[model samples]
Target chain A: MPSTTSTRPGGRSARVRAAVHHAVEELLSENPAEAVTLPLIAARAGVHPTTVYRRWGSLAELLSEVATSRFSGDIVVPDSGSLREDLERWAIDVSTDLSDPDTVALMRATLGSAAEGGCACVGDRHAQLDAMLERERSRGGKAPGVQTAADALLSPLYYRALFTTEPMEPGWVRGLVRNLLR
Target chain B: MPSTTSTRPGGRSARVRAAVHHAVEELLSENPAEAVTLPLIAARAGVHPTTVYRRWGSLAELLSEVATSRFSGDIVVPDSGSLREDLERWAIDVSTDLSDPDTVALMRATLGSAAEGGCACVGDRHAQLDAMLERERSRGGKAPGVQTAADALLSPLYYRALFTTEPMEPGWVRGLVRNLLR
Candidate 1:
């Protein structure tokens, strides 16, 4: 399983990957996870259905690739010198991302995949959370364990984002950071 | 709309509703929400598809009805009088519910509806959460607002339930309660 796409930037194969990725985003914007199919994605991307099938064996694999590539640069740990400020900024950043319609669609898609398809790519999200928390701990933040810290700092944003109609305001993010720090 | 079913105990219409409800649970156990349709439910319940359609306008409405009726009686706020104990019990109860395969399936389904279908019945779950929190507050427990309390108390269970492979253990529930209370 060597790279199907070229290592060089802007190559023909790379263009295919990019097209497929954009097609996924477009489909997810309008439909939930269960509604997205390989044929539709291929048609939207203007790629051959056989190419999509060969390149991505299943919908879960394609979604995982798209989610990882799209969100990998979304979160960056802040070094504000104070744990409170760093946590607040990080929480707000994540909140903003979650609040975006496209991002919310992605969240729904990934969570749906995890729940129904048992997709292992869900670990990517937890890994991102762990890396963010680990950075804070390295900078002398006195937070709980990585898992617990994730529950404290990140769960609320996701909770509201998914379950409730309540707004995820900036002040609430500040409160979350203060509570987690305390 | 007047009552489609009589209030009398074990009436004909009551039996019909019960059969339909059980059919929904059974179908959801084997399939995702989108896969469960009115005809399938009617056939499984030994009723007519038109009956289900007339009784419940859409799948989201029907699922919401089933979820609300089923879970309304599941959580009873304990009078242990201590907010810490009460919160821990509630969290564990929710953890156990999330661990149950049927409940998790239902959660995924309803969340799917909320995320994709713009289902309004998602408010039913928040109402249950608020009622539980108000009970604790009425008992002299000094906690955060109901929405925030739901975030602190229940969000982590859902986060792990929907997002990651993490086990929502009893110990973690205790820890969540302790942190939220502190």
Candidate 2:
């Protein structure tokens, strides 16, 4: 009974979650998946397969967990009071983050499952952007609507990362922000 | 000896090509692929599987062919004598085309094989944009660079098509064009 309640912070459950996530990231980065499986990740993480299955339920969910952690939690959304400054910084951060091979890999996996309902990553970004835009409106500052901001700012970044070879050019994001807000 | 050149217009090779493409479009629209195999397509088209494999080499190449035929050749890039008008027309054309379920299915397939070198569909759009931009420059009309045009116009269309449920709003595309130009 005590052990059942022991799935607390820094406890065995926390350790398992962390280890599985680390293993998933490592496996995803190690190569384009020739089938990155639940058992493979479990073995890499040194947790029992059932533990991962019982907790995450599937590979897609596990991949999504890792992605959600990074996109929604780890990456900071800027709040510099100016919409242009905030958007430029945010776009640049996104471009930088997506430049990582692992992120690109994760996106490839998610985008398929994501196609039906829309990308969770996009939802997270849309939420972050909505908050920033709301703040700008409250401060009596002019800002584009969320969809406009997403189209002008975010879509290009994701499009480049997923579908094109070109890097997001230096200072281009600032220019995009300037052009958009103007 | 004449058989070698039988790929001429309306010949057996042309017929086969048409049939195969028709089959692919039909099959793609039929379902999210539980693996849209060469064999399945060949059977549907009444062409030999070897014919599909020989002509297209792989499923990825076949998918690209279907995509290229639509995006580059079928979908006309406009020339309205004004850069803004041309861009708006082109953007609206793209938004309309990608709204189809079949294109979405094709995109899902291409995006995976396309990750390393960039999507062929994107290349087609870039080339079309470049052609239009070059024409604008020749006419002494100021236009954004091809990459800028792609970022401003094409990326948003494809991004929303592939990654979101929201329809490309009726007048919103025109507004996007004006905003980007400004």
Candidate 3:
């Protein structure tokens, strides 16, 4: 179970959560995923282990919170009146996010844990993606085969990011979108 | 350096390598990537630590050998006179290999090590892929925009295989091929 409850009386709790989330991101950026431990997170967050546990339940849950939080900012949606244009813009955004070193590291860590013992966080990612896709589908935007097209639009960025040592560029994402939707 | 060469060469040597590889695969299948260890691999393989060390420099190197061996079979390059058919066949092959429980475990372990210390084996996988692409390009059997098309054709299967807990089906590969090529 995740610790979603606010410890303090209202606005102050949000600040604490934000601080902890930021610290987790910073630590994940600097260290390998395997190196992150409860003690390190607590030390970096300037909080006690119990507090983190109370909030996020386990280290996996906390990491999931941090992972999801990184993408909580503005999401890019494509609406260029052309499916190609829409997909290209969306692909670029997804590619950029996947290419980020911190994002890649966190994903690898999460996936590694999933491989080990089935991380519940991966389900969260899927649900988030499904919701976003549902939103897109509900809109007037429709492709001939959107699900497969979307997978084609997004998978390469992640594959290159995770497997290859080189960073994936926006050009590759654009090329991928062009080839898939052409 | 990976321990590909043993000081003694004979039937026993071949058996030892085979035993070690099998052991590594079994351990990977049974345990999470983090739980796999040199001592455990040795015990499972029925070999001494010295032999394990002599065969592979480190656990990472040994695991790389295991992954390589698992994928060592000849790539079934299709020649059905159409680029789409060829690519679909390739995708099915890759999807089948990736969907295996052992293969998934190996991939998790490989990516985990890659995230931690930058596994050299990833370069090997890329080199193999590049070589295959180069061969196809030289053969001139593929359609226009072969490189981009190839990425679009194959990336989705690999991505789904890696991220999803469900086993990838041959139909999924076929759909990816049809959708990308359409």
Candidate 4:
């Protein structure tokens, strides 16, 4: 069988992976969900279709590589001793990050794409969110009230972003935190 | 200039209206968003595109007609005195209705179709949700413990339905109500 690898041997593999990542990002930037096709991604990344398929298995997986690259950076969890304050800080940061137009659009696209069929990317996204929540809980110290606190802190931001045209303002985040904690 | 009035002093006007309404229901049943083009709708209804435009003015209005025709029968909100029970009933109904594979697929398609570009249907859907919330609040009464009982009551059901493949079971709805009430 002919070798289907896009990378020839050793040194070229890293370069090919980087190229594919960049191409996926560029496609998402242009058209969120509409631009994610395997052939187009392969052409842009200068790899054969077989190579792309061999590497990621599916277009959703390829897109997952691009989407998650930006999210793995350090997420600081403040420990101000007060659970309310800690949650407030976390909500502010999360609301600000999630309220970005591009981010919201990308999320909507991801949801839409997943609704069409199966995508491991959706599972990865959920895992990432769960990890972030877990980290925050650990930092602040979980109480009996932690799960409800977490839901109250996060659900509104997501609901607002999905249903309303208005960007989630800092004021809303602060209000949500205060109300939930109180 | 031809009048855009739906009710005309003619023989075929009433028949045409009925046919259009039936066609809208049939099409939406099959594929909510895909089945809503003016030409296709008119063809299915055995009417003219001009007639559809004359009556509804836009695709969103046409969709609204279909949705209202199908699901607007009656949503009885019982005043059980206990917010948890009332919410449980409401959540079960909403989740059960939305969890229908056809309904879920249709909603996804409608949402995705709206995300693709400017679709008045988006605004219409939001308005409908808001209206439903308002009606429930007035009918069911509210609890003092939660910030907004409505949010706590409804958000999880929606979030779970949108993200997970698990069927919305009665136990899940009961658990959600219990958790929110806590």
lDDT ranking from best to worst?
2, 1, 3, 4
Say which prediction, candidate 2 or candidate 4, comes out ahead on lDDT.
2
Q: Which residue pairs clash within candidate 3?
A: A3-A55, B3-B55
What would the per-residue lDDT of candidate 2 be over residues B56-170, giving only the tens digit for each residue? Answer: 9977788778777756765687988988788778878878888887778777656544335466665477887888889989998787887778788887888888778888875
**For candidate 1, lDDT tens digit of each residue in B44-147?**
99998998899888776787788777766666656576667767777787788777778777766665554443333233445555665677778776666766
Query: Over the stretch B74-157, how does candidate 4's per-residue lDDT look in tens digits?
Result: 345545655556667766877777676655554444443333332222233333344444555677744333334434545555
Fnat, one value per model:
0.29, 0.41, 0.34, 0.11
Taking the tens digit of each residue's C-alpha lDDT, what string does model 3 give over A1-182? 13654554455577778878878778878876667777788888788888888877766677666655665543546555566666667667776777677777777666665544343323333443444455556776544454555466656666667665666677777777666645
- Model 4 residue B141 distance off true place after TM-score fit, in angstroms: 6.8
Q: Name model 2 segments beyond 4 Å from true.
A: A1-20, A37-66, B2-13, B47-57
TM-score of each: 0.84, 0.84, 0.76, 0.64
Q: lDDT per residue, candidate 4, A1-182, as tens digits?
A: 14545446544677878888777666656763543678888899999989889988875466555556644443466666666566677668767776666555555545544434332222333443445446657776554344455346555665556555656677767876666655
- The share of true interface contacts that also appear in candidate 3 amounts to 0.34
TM-score of 2: 0.84
Tens digits of per-residue lDDT, candidate 2, A40-70, equal 9999999999999999887767766777776
Top of the candidates by lDDT: 2
Tens-place lDDT digits, model 1, residues A13-60 = 889999999998999888755578899999999999999999888766
Give the poorly placed runs of model 4, Cα more than 4 Å off.
A1-18, A32-61, A64-82, A115-150, A178-182, B1-85, B116-150, B171-182
Q: How much does each candidate deviate from the true structure in C-alpha RMSD?
A: 3.5, 3.3, 4.8, 6.0
Instruction: List iRMS (one decimal) for every candidate.
Output: 4.1, 2.4, 3.5, 4.8
Q: Order of all candidates by DockQ, from best down to worst?
A: 2, 1, 3, 4
lDDT of 3 at A59: 65
DockQ of each: 0.39, 0.44, 0.38, 0.24
Tell me the spans in candidate 3 whose CA falls farther than 4 Å from its real position.
A1-20, A50-58, A72-74, A78-83, A116-142, B1-16, B48-58, B78-84, B116-140, B144-146, B165-167, B180-182
